[model samples]
Target: MTVPSGIYIRKARIQDVRTIHALLMDCSKQGLLLPRSYNQLYSHLRDFFVLAQDQGAILGCCALSITWDDLAEVRSLAVAPECRGQGWGRRLVEACLSDAITLGIFRIFTLTYQAHFFERLGFQVVSKDNLPQKVWADCLHCPKFPDCDEIAMSIEM
Candidate 1:
């Protein structure tokens, strides 16, 4: 799907971190996804792809963090409230998937509340146990660690 006119997806830049953090935080407060700290965002800045308007406002962001040799986790996906349903979120994810393929990784998984959204993008529900233990290291800090309600989904591209 093409991005909405005036909006485009690109690698996250250092200047975009604060806006990305704010967007993720807004989504987190609505119980949409996990929030990341400035530290985490800065450290993993290279993992992010952001959707921005032509005027340069960030509308959404997502990250593809490599988990194991053949696995990568899609996390921190968020789209502005006004921009939902316009295909911007999917575009952000596609950017990540493109990056993954470029890096020679084929398996992409996500712990998400929007299962149908990912499903439409070719992701399937999977058992959490099927994921590597190392994938949970960050979960240790999640508020829902022991009882995460987010559905685990994967797509082999």
Candidate 2:
């Protein structure tokens, strides 16, 4: 379902899982992102904030996973192909940032191929070596790990 922007962003519901999974898989298949298992989605359901209108059709998905006392990682930010070019991706990221700010988390980061896209959103390029070793836990599960070439970017709220 294509939901036009300009509506409120809210916490995702249990029923949104399957559709969200499909959204992630669509990006993953194109090698633009990682594929998340349904089990993982269920386990981290609360970590997500899905964008939709009053009717509640999931337009995009992004998760803010808390890591350590001062940092959080934004993962699996996939906007439907139809929704790209619009400001939906930025709005979704902004929603996560706003939520993080409310929770007192000011450091946010992401691993992505769309470096320029995120750069415009205030994310700066950073060396992967500077990231906490704990963050590598997820990388191990990625099909493209050490050899992976996604750029790492960060921002301070």
Q: Which structure among the candidates has the greatest TM-score?
A: 1
Q: Each model's TM-score, in the order given? A: 0.94, 0.89
Residue 97, candidate 1: Cα error in Å is 0.9
Best by lDDT: 1
**Over 4 Å off in model 2, which ranges?**
1-7
Query: 9-122, model 2: which lDDT tens digit per residue?
Result: 678889999999999999989987778999999999998988776676777889888876898888889988877787888878888898899899998899898889899999
lDDT of 1 at 5: 81
Score residue 3 of candidate 2 by CA lDDT: 49
What is candidate 2's TM-score against the reference? 0.89
Instruction: Compute the lDDT of residue 23 as modeled in candidate 1.
Output: 97
Which 10-residue window of candidate 1 scores lowest in summed lDDT?
Answer: 132-141
